[model samples]
Target: MTHAELHADAFATLSAWTPPSHGQFSLREAYLGFLAARPDATARSCAPGHLTASAVVMSADRRSVLLTLHPRVGRWLQLGGHCEDGDSSLAAAAFREATEESGIDGLVMDPAPLDLDVHPITCSLGIPTRHFDVRFLVTAPPGAVAVISDESDDLRFWPVDALPPGTDASVTTLVAAAVARG
Candidate 1:
């Protein structure tokens, strides 16, 4: 499918998804607003902003989560980034990003997203933009080894109970939501 088609699919997926039990009611409205504001929300269209897909990667025992020290943000965060051209859906994009960033193969992802967030970012050339992030829950098999991608300064598994000192609250919330779902 073309990039436009893929974006349409993502919008539809978001539209059909039921809001999570703990989610804010405004999230759905914000998502819909994003869809209306940008046609390339699923691709890197960047017409004021774009959509991003992310995963909260959990270890097999469910005690650890893989976090990347983002080079740009300078903070430990979930594995995720911009949706690529060939992605068929938001879930696929999130899975692909998780796999690429974590360097772990054979990962399994939940079809339903664990959380949604809209945040501001300064992209290439210092353009202010928003990332309408759709986050999924991903699981790594026992003994899976993760390699840090060039995009990150470091990659490590953090115990869910003891996230790093500067961990983002959004990441912490996502970990809790993933744990609660399982």
Candidate 2:
């Protein structure tokens, strides 16, 4: 499927379900609002119980970012997942997701969150529907090889200027902003 199709499908999956446990209450509420406001849009809010965090893992050279092709969502996404109970902070949760999904060890990530975004999911039913996605900026050593995990069907690096066709626009904006700041 095309990238847009993949994104739409993923959003559909999220919208059909309620937020996860790790999601913040305010974010969850906002997500529901989005779903109600834009039913025609392909995204829905994640339920409170299904909230999760993610990280935008970048190579040390700062030329590329690590992304995973999630099997369920079937979209190219940054490395991230649900925040388990033991995570001390959002950044930690993002870190865990990054490592687990990408299998790139020894990564160094900022202690704080880099950006916050909210997107609606369209997949789950009887759920509040949305993910208040919190993303972090993480760096790996130059030339690090990414090992894809079960969560993702593939793992690879894409150039900052020329990303894969299916990447989220928000991700590109964030990456560009970071590059500008540096």
Pick by lDDT: which candidate is best? 1
lDDT of each: 0.86, 0.64
Once fitted onto the true fold, the runs of candidate 1 whose alpha carbons sit more than 4 angstroms away are none
Candidate 1 residues 19-92, lDDT tens each? 77646447866887878777766666565778889999999999999999999999999999888878888899
Lowest summed-lDDT stretch of 10 residues in model 1?
Answer: 20-29
Off by over 4 Å in 2: 1-51, 122-128
Q: Which candidate is the best by TM-score?
A: 1
Please give each candidate's TM-score: 0.94, 0.69
Cα RMSD of predicted structure 1: 1.4
Q: Write the per-residue lDDT of candidate 2 for residues 8-118, one digit (tens) a residue.
A: 433453444443334434554564564345433332232432435688888787888887887867877788765454565556677888888777779998754455566
Residue 92 C-alpha lDDT in model 2: 68
